[model samples]
Target: MQFLSAYAAALIVFGILDAVWLSIMGRLLYRPTLGSLMLDNLRWAPALVFYFLFPVGVVHFAVLPAFAAGSLQTALVNGGFLGLLAYATYDLTNYATLRVWTLTLTLVDVVYGAAATAIVAGGAYGALRVLASAGWI
Candidate 1:
């Protein structure tokens, strides 16, 4: 459980940092095309894991603060970011949905942490219990 909590927090923090960075970059260069959006930018939306992780990270870091600060071109990209983040976050959020039966932002990280702990502990306990009953040394 402790390990799960730590790993999950790390993952979320990494995500927040990546988003802030993307939003920042998106606000900066104002790339003319997604083609030149950035390396690995918006490249893989289809992949369930790590999809939009790169592009979204770039766009989030680039655009978010600008939007909060009331910048012009910054807000324009919000729609695009929303589309990407929605899907990407959805993919990432799915990590927890299976266990808790809910898919809200709150459960996104919670489920991941809980599931990890449950899986690890369950496995270990099952193995130990079986070993003990079997009289194995």
Candidate 2:
């Protein structure tokens, strides 16, 4: 139950933050360079898949570990590293193989991913701690 709550909270936080970032900055940043590859219309299926699955990865690789250890600091560092790795795997692969990919986009995305994940994990962990203390967990 605790793990489930933490996962749910973290997913919500990440989804909201990413949506804002993608809307305000991501479209402008990627469209110019990857215009040909960018979809003309949003595809709900794949977008939803990525968004949902990505948080699961964070929960498994980062959040759960910190929660198990009872260390919010662990979540911060591990979550950030996990996010960096996850984003780098995609961005770096694209930068290497995709001619349209740019360093600017890659840097921005990886950095954003790391920061966002760290914040989400930390916030989720703190919230869970509060809930547990209040006997709400």
Best by lDDT: 2
* Model 1 lowest lDDT segment of ten: 116-125
What is the RMSD of candidate 1? 19.7
Give the residue spans of candidate 1 off by over 4 A.
Answer: 29-48, 51-137
Q: Return the TM-score for each candidate structure.
A: 0.27, 0.92
Deviation in angstroms for 103 in model 1?
41
Error of 2 at 58 (Å): 1.5
Worst 10 residues of 2 by lDDT: 54-63
What lDDT, from 0 to 1, does candidate 2 have? 0.86
Q: Residue 37 of candidate 1: its Cα lDDT?
A: 27
> How displaced is residue 121 in candidate 1, in Å?
23
Please name the candidate that would achieve the greatest TM-score relative to the true structure. 2
lDDT of 2 by residue, 1-137 (tens): 87788888888999899889988885679787788787888899998898888777777777778878999899899889988998999999999999889999899999998999898888788877888899998
Superposed model 2: Cα runs more than 4 Å off: none
